[model samples]
Target chain A: MKNPIDNLNKVFDSRIRLGVMSVLLVNEEINFNDLKDLLQLTDGNLASHLSHLEENGFIKVRKGFIGRKTNTTYSITKAGEKAFKDHLAGLENMIKSIK
Target chain B: MRSKEESLDALQDIRKMMERSSRFISLSGWSGISAGICALLGAWFGYGVLARTGGESVSASSRTSQVGLSSMGEIQQLLLIGRLTFAAAAVSAFIFTYIRSKKNAIPMWGLTAKRLLINTMVPMIVGGLVILRMMQTGYYDLVGSCSLVFYGLALVNASKYTLNEIRYLGYAELALGLIDLWQRGYGLLFWALGFGVLHIIYGTMMWWKYERVQSK
Candidate 1:
């Protein structure tokens, strides 16, 4: 199989997105605002990154009402999880090969 | 009435804030160093207390072995020292955190303190009372494990108010408690691992990832 990192959609390639992915991978599900605060990114910037990841089908975004307030929660899709794991493996391999 | 668009925008803003807040920033590096120092000192004191009081008498492989805290001849002094050392280390962490916050204009004490106190105290107080009752009833055997279990409960219960790192700490403590439940008689070692090693590991990780880079 091709190295998963080789096929990593550069669509979700930014540092913030990578960070968001890492956090989401560890946590079962996280809301949109929590991701922004954790990453310390502005609203528009986070929105754009989320939009990009959503477009790539790497993340599933849900919009619903949370206690009379509209809530948006994001979770990693199966594809996203596989991609992340593969990405980490590929990065490890690349690092090992570097030396 | 406010327009639907305005409400949607506001909700969007709240969501953004929540995401930003969700990332867990670990305890400062100094906090780890302080906690480790506390744990070691506490252990050393504990050892000394036990030694002076004729030391902790653990039978070779007993699960429900009694802890000989009553024979305080050599152990009393050691216990005193351990208590002092642990107290000092905890105080140092508080002081260090306070100083850092003051220098950075971060509000460390008020809300964080309130939350931590609520988290640390509720279960801790209840656990402390229970342990005291147990000890009075000659159940010194269960004190150590109770400490671990209640401490974990405190962390888990209070994890919602502040940084998510606390939740992990809670889980680690819970693991330690389970280890205690088996009553393998490795009391001191488990205490050190749970209170000392874990803090240092978490602290160092936090320092490396966030504080170090920011201060640079």
Candidate 2:
């Protein structure tokens, strides 16, 4: 099995990165730590994935301060949204073909 | 500020967020506006029907017009104004949401027509019948609450196809209905809560969480 997630497979293949993108796709903006908790990834792992996505123009990273601690938030870009939606559509088509 | 690998990693994280949240975009402003219009119009027609008759005690089958200065008359007049006010607020809110959607360049009525019809018809038809029943019985007092309750039910039932916030809106209406059922005389407060205040609150939330946030 080539994995139906093949063509749909993200250009960035790490499960952690895919997971992070998936979360940002839905929420308008999510903080770094909240993403950390949701994905159960280490601080280093999450940060690496975020950097990748932001570089790809798939997401936008905003930095600000909440109280004293610096807050970093992530949101999906149009290209990112398109990629995700196409992936789902591809998966659905694959499922239909299997049936 | 970061190495090539670090930059790649950040972009990947952003992509992952986009993927996860894509399925649940915020409701089109038009949807809220359309719903508001439907609600206002429904309220108008429902309240008007009641005005032609009288109180909950009045027989539904009777066509007798009750326009005198009796208690029913006073109540009817108050409710008439309330319904009009509700219609105005909803219409204005609808306009506000619609204009915002257009301004943001979100596709208006991009929804498939068939789904839109089914979603619009179910609650509306059911609500229409309910309103008619209320009118016949002259449950004019219950008219305001009934509108809110039925409208909420519509939103809850049809929420699968559209905005999830609508379901919350329905729950709010149901709450208002229960409050109204508990106290029969305070129609104005319930109207304000259900039609006026609730819309503003829900609209603001929708705008804040989905609209004003300006997702990249």
Candidate 3:
């Protein structure tokens, strides 16, 4: 039997990272400021979490200019979605086992 | 190590953040209240114009079988007043929404806000054009009903992008429009009830539900 704990993705272990993934799952694309505002995270903290997700290839980033201002947007990848679902399943299984 | 309760709370928080990011929630109750007051005032002014012209028509027809002021002239004046009232209400609504967004530290011109405006404006623009054409062809009696119906449609269409409670207001306006259509001559009264009274009630409910608790 596989350990349910093994199914929890380390990349999404942080609450902030989990929050980011949760937001990106629902929204097609979200700009940086919106994510920052929603998560209530400092600039440095959000940037580092985004970098971690980017390095893991779980989220894609697009940087562009909007009327002379640089805009950064983030979206979840297919891999990210699958990982999130598996994590949720693991959580449910763990709870069921406990009950 | 996080406890089960902590994990569950984190999940809930994430869900809320996702919902907040995707949906526009900066709509102010003050916008509805101001619009309602404007609509009431506009209805009063409309009543004044109608009474003056109606009295003139009756007395002039009895005396000389002709109206003192041409029916066309009266209609033109009423149309102008309607336009003015609509403009005032729209401006006030915009101002209140802008103020609320600023207060909430939310961008007023975000993607969701743009989508909401576009969806709401499309039906309103089409309705305005149709009403203007009707006025040109002297179908003044149908103007009130058409405006109400179109405005209701606009609200319903835009409700997907904003608070869902607005859909109820849209339904009420649509029902009022249909009733006005059947009643024919009581357009102003129905308009007042639909726009004036309904908006105030909606505004009060929204304020009580959303704003009052926040301030407390």
Candidate 4:
């Protein structure tokens, strides 16, 4: 078997990106405020990480207006879902094989 | 290159973050609120049962001796009511909890939830036994206090597996049970306060914290 490390995606190496992917994979969509609260991260840090995931085509971002205020939401793209699952499976295999 | 331990830790962290719940608690707030309502209703029915049976001591004496149709099988009736109330509460709470878990796409009976259930059930099963024994020996006065204390212990023990909010509720239950122990003849009152009122208050807070707040 090929090394599982070789199958892992580098994007998920960062804890924040991994967290965002994990949440989006489970939830249909999560708004910016709730996501921020869940992760307990500042707006700037979360935004940068969110943008990084968006750039990799691993997540979809949507901006809309909820009444007067602008609402930003995020969800995992199809590619993201597959990539994340693969990364997680790879990590599991890596742990089992390495251990 | 990370070691095996670090990789495993990351996997665990991913699961925790994915839950959309507090680090420990997988149980939802809606369950708490509904359970409280059921408890209140049960207490009301229980109180009505006692009032109709000429109260506890009178019913106890009637149980031993031959009496008219007044006190016939009061304990059995009360026990049946208790069982039904427990069943209703459990079913309703399960429904609400299942809905929340489904919306979150979290498996209801996953390993973490199983651990929570096991931690909660241990003290509860033991308490059920103690309660049954008390009823068999006719130490009826201590029944309410025992139930409260045991339930509190169960909640506290399971707090490590669930939300920390349960710990405070457990403490409240312990305090109420002790007071009931000190002053007997008010089991139903204490039961109502502990399980009914306290559950509603705490459940609302939990719902607000986890559900309403999150929806925003």
Candidate 5:
């Protein structure tokens, strides 16, 4: 018998990363500040989680300047969307199995 | 291993965050309520103007007992009153929405809000221009219905970026506008029903559903 836990993506195991993916899935592109505000995460914590997702090729980052200030925006890749959906299915299945 | 409750809580949190990112959820119920009150007051003022103008024409031309159409000056005065009332309502609505957004720690200006504003304003602007033209050509009977229909379209257009419940209000407005069109000569009554009564009902429901819980 295969373990249901195997369906859950390892990258999405962290709540913060999951949160970042969830927000990215709904929006076309979100700036770093808006992400931070939505997730309610500290600057360093959000940056670290973003880098991890970027390294995994789940999201793409675009750095630009709005006025004199640097603005970084993030968007989800197709891979990210598929992975998040799978992970969500896994979660739903897990809940279903419990009931 | 995380417990089921923890997982469920995380799921709920994710859902909320996603919704927040895509939707302008900071619209306050008070904005709708104040707008309703303003519409009612405007309707009352408009009724008074019409009555006074009609009474004046009756008194001036005793031979023709029929109420004559208002003069250009009287019409201009009524239009000015309508514009002032609309401006007051808009400002009050903005103030209430700003306060609610601040209290909720949501940015009042953002991508979702910008989209909502653009979508809502496009229909309203078109409707305003059309109404103005209709007034110029003396098709005043259709003015109230056109305003309601266009305003309904605006709300429906903008509803995609805000709470889904707003769509119902849009539909209600559209229905009222259509009914008003069918039943002419009661434009002001339908305007009161659409803007005043409908807004108060929607605002009360929204407050009960969203804000009341938060207050507790």
Candidate 6:
């Protein structure tokens, strides 16, 4: 048997990343403002975590305009979804083993 | 290995986040209550029109008087009342839902809401078209029952995106519709029961379950 924690993605270590991924998993995409509102995070903090996910290719960014204002939306990539799901599976396994 | 408790907490957190993001739970129980009131009011008005048309037993005898509404004027009048009632209920529900979402700090038109609307609307739209065709073909007796059935399906379809209580309401409507199918002539009565009475009951239950507990 293998240790489940070892199989966890290191990028998911932060709670914000976990939250972002979780939100994206259920939604097709979320605009920056809406995501910020959902997470209740300050602009700088959300930006940093979002950039981190983007850097790791765990999420994709789409920049478009809603009339005059530019809107930036985020959605989980296939890799991101798989990684999050795997992380979840690992968590589930840990529970099963302990029980 | 980490303790089971720690893993459990993480799993709970994940479940919460996913559910919140995916489901539109901001719908106020008041939405149901108001919609039910509107439906009941509509039924009363419809009954009035039926009475004025010299069709005393709008609930029974008159339905068998002929295949459908006796005259185009009567159909138009009943339809107008029905449409008004539906519009009133919808608007009221939307207003209540919007206010509740605002209070809860949830986005009103998010993807979850969009999905909910789309899922519910598809069935409702199909049902609407089918019912219209029935009206044209003089199958008025079946209209009320079918509406109940279709409305039930729409709610059941959208239940995943909203409160679980609605699913039960949907089920009740579906059951009533099925029973009304064989009963015939009783379409008006069943429609009132399914749309009017059932809504009030469902709305009250929802309010008691969610709003009462939360507010108090």
User: How big is the positional error of residue B36 in model 4, measured in Å on the Cα after superposition?
Assistant: 1.2
Error of 6 at B24 (Å): 0.8
lDDT of 1 by residue, B96-188 (tens): 667665655544544335546776789989998997787567555566777788988987887775556767888998898787768665676
TM-score: the better of candidates 1 and 6: 6
After TM-score superposition, the amount by which residue B164's alpha carbon in candidate 1 deviates from its true location, in angstroms, is 0.8
Candidate 3 chain B: worst 10 consecutive residues by lDDT?
B56-65
For model 6, residues B1-216, the per-residue Cα lDDT tens digits are 467887777777777778778788888878888888888888888788778877757553345436443655677877898999999999998998898888777778876787799999999999999999987776777888899999999999889888877899999999999998888457678888888888888878877876787677
User: Per-residue error at B211 for model 1, in Å?
Assistant: 0.8
Q: Show the lowest summed lDDT stretch of 10 residues, model 5 chain B.
A: B56-65
Interface-residue RMSD per candidate?
Answer: 14.3, 13.5, 2.6, 6.8, 1.6, 2.1
Q: Could you give candidate 5's per-residue lDDT for residues A6-87 as a string of tens digits?
A: 7788898898999999999999899998888887789999999999999999999999999999999999999999988988
Candidate 1 structure quality by residue, lDDT tens digits, A45-91: 99998898888788999898889998899998998888766655555
Give lDDT tens digits, candidate 3, residues B69-90. Answer: 5655666666677778888888
- Candidate 3 regions exceeding 4 Å error are A1-7, A32-47, A62-73, A88-99, B55-69
Query: lDDT of each prediction vs. the true structure?
Result: 0.65, 0.61, 0.80, 0.80, 0.84, 0.83
Best of the candidates, TM-score: 5
lDDT tens digits, residue span B1-216, model 4: 977887898899898887543333546787877888888898888778777866763223324344436644766777787788789889988998888777776656654566688889999999999999987777777877888999999989888767778899999999999888887557778887888888888888888887886667
Per-residue C-alpha lDDT of model 2 across residues B1-216, encoded as one tens digit per residue: 223444345455655444323322334444454445445454455545555655353221222244345645555654566556556655665565556545644433433223444775788678778877876776555666777777777767666555566678878888887777666555544665576566656766676676665644
Model 1 alpha-carbon drift over 4 Å, by segment: A1-99, B1-27, B52-70
DockQ per model, Cα: 0.04, 0.14, 0.44, 0.23, 0.61, 0.51
Candidate 3 local lDDT, A1-99, one digit each (tens) = 776677778787788998999889988898898788777789999999999999988899999989999999999999888998887776666665555
Residue range with the least summed lDDT across 10 consecutive positions in model 1 chain A: A4-13
Interface RMSD of 3: 2.6
Native contact fraction, candidates in order: 0.05, 0.33, 0.47, 0.57, 0.57, 0.68
| Ranking of all candidate structures by their DockQ, best first | 5, 6, 3, 4, 2, 1
lDDT of 5 by residue, B72-116 (tens): 555666688678779988998899889989989888887678878
